[model samples]
Target: MNRFDRFLAIDWSGAMGERQRGIQIAYLDIEAGTGPVLMRLPDAKNWGRVVIKNLLMKLARADRRTLVGLDFCFSVPWPEEGPLPEGEAPLDRVEELWDLVENICSGEAHYYAGPAIRSMESAFAPYILCDRYRGDEFRFDRFRETESQLSPKPASIYHCMGAKQIGPGSFAGMRMFHALRAVNDHRIAIWPFDPIEDANVVLCEMYPSLFYQMAGLKRAYDHETIQNTLAYFHSGSPPRMSIQDEADAVISVAALRALAADPTLFSDPRRVAAAQREGWIFGLAPS
Candidate 1:
């Protein structure tokens, strides 16, 4: 039976691998195999290509049924194709990169290429629900439920791809990226970020007490966001002294989700961690 053997959770950004601290931080998750990689790219130009290239290559090499999830807008309405009026020709790189991702994740290419991670906006029709952060839970009956704040005008076909009114760093923005990818790719599965409603039960499987303690630290062993703490643990490194300790914990949460999905396919925690020292450790197998 064909089943998933490995997976990758990516928090991608245009500025990935170009942070002042170091660009390699994104791969920290993939390399460490501890949590969700913080993919802070430098900009939009080659970002899409760079991400896809690495992802595709990794999936190819693993020779396993791998699922890669990313929180980013992957689709946009095809604008009127015409000649640029002035000096905007060089920017064609953006569209080109977008096409690459769309093609790889959609139609016939996706079935053979690999699995995709998309957001709620896409047409994948995956069910999702959200806790609404209000403490009062709400279920999303539709494939996608947009925020009530959008205004008098209804959402357009392109609404999913536009910059969310809330701006970056907010979960709202993440949804736009996911929706775009969903519409573009047939194989990708789109979902929401709500804890209670989403089918991605992995987010809820972490050791909470340990997870929170690690997540709420002053300094991180590695320079990761507060949401990435747990992912670092898979690297065999204990929490470091940094303000971003919570980041490590968050990362760890992602790793555990991957681990819980199919524990038998993973290695002993001790052995898997040891392999991390040699190079990137995506996952382990049962001993």
Candidate 2:
């Protein structure tokens, strides 16, 4: 397993907007001997996906191994090809899935993927159960094998409705992956999709809730709970955070630093072949 110089945890959001307040980023420097701090860009309060991408590019170019945990699914379960444009062939792999998402959401501002999703709302209507996009075939079933390994069985990539629905973030994140790959090559790698032995930056899926659970908390809504959570990782209290997202980010990165060194994380994820295309969550064991 590779040791990282820095750990970044993002509480990502895909809500439609020019800027998303729910998207929070925090990082910890392994050599700094300090706690995780919410990353504040020079002029941005809320983060736009494009800005996040640029930050990632800068990190990719840096000559240090960095572990970045993005709070979203990397790929959908390969339930056959989603509704494709006429004459387009079904995608064979995750990168191709990213390309398809990029094509569908091209020109979308703030990297919002509403258009790409709305385009397929009809074909996948049965899977979506949200009030607005509820499909006739909506059934709360279907999940990647890796996800099924977790106790709660986090939402399926196909679940596009309700609060747990991370489908929007998943789709938008794919576009970011595609964009990063187009420019950076081996500098940055999304684990389980792109090989990572020589990459300076590596990205993986994260679920902040898992870390909070480790500390016996539900959410980092208060400073005391935040302190307790960080303490579990031997980290100091986070700087005063006003929003829940900020607290989540702070705790998450601290947890990432604590969990990144496990050798199992760098090993094969599961028996399912789709796992290569549909990535695994970083800290969770595939067993």
Candidate 3:
């Protein structure tokens, strides 16, 4: 259980655009202990899904032991009773779902998952909530088993409420992860799906709210509160962090560093069998 050298936190977005302004990536070097700086694309462009993949590849090549936490679910739920094709059985693994989404969204630009979401609505609708449509099995309070284990209880990825929609990001993220893994160059390993032993880079699901709670930031929007959160992780605060997303990215990485220091962290995953397809949030035990 060696520690990762670098920790990165991705404040991801699932917006419809070539580059989403909401997307942000921040990193900290455990050894350097100086920064958790926000990353930007060249020419001041916004961060896009494709750009994120490229960055992961570059990090993998560098061979630094890195831990990346994407602010999205790595996988979705697979209920015992849900929509599926006429002959196909329920998906048993996250890797397969990643490929399925990628193939479905091949025509989608920037790995946006709009097309896939529409095309596969029937199969996943039972879990996802929409304004006009809710699957036969859909329940407003329904969420994956892993999500229910959190303290405050996270919003369901199945829920499509604006400002709370996290499902779309998972679809797009799976596509990104699939592309990174499909290269066969072995640039990355998706945690729990792939073992962490000696891997140069590993990515996992992250929820900033969990880190916020852990950092004792009772008020995330307050300037002093955000600074205190950063200070808790030994970041001591940086500049230009007036927005919530910026704080999320910076605080996330710093928290990740502090959390990773606990060698026993995530050593035993709860509900292991189910977490195989419904990925667990980082720093939480699957339930």
Q: Pick by TM-score: which candidate is best? A: 3
Residues 70-155 of candidate 1: C-alpha lDDT, one tens digit per residue: 33332222223311222233223323433443443444221221211233332221211221121111123111112121222222
Clashing pairs in 2: 125-135, 126-137, 126-138
The estimated TM-scores of all candidates read 0.30, 0.89, 0.90
Better of 2 and 3 by lDDT: 2
Task: Please report the TM-score between candidate 1 and the true structure.
Answer: 0.30
Instruction: Quote the lDDT for 34 in model 1.
Output: 50
Model 2 C-alpha lDDT per residue in residues 1-287, reported as the tens digit of each score? 43899999998988877778889999899888898888877886788888889888889889888999999988866554543333457767788888878877887877787765565433344555554665555556666666777766787766776777888898889888888879956788888777777888889888888888888777758867888989998897688688888888898899888887776666756344767877787777766
Task: Indicate the worst ten consecutive residues by lDDT in candidate 1.
Answer: 141-150
Cα misplacement distance, residue 60 of candidate 1 (Å): 4.2
How should the candidates be ordered by TM-score, best one leading?
3, 2, 1
Best by lDDT: 2
Q: Candidate 1, after superposition: displacement of residue 228 in Å?
A: 11
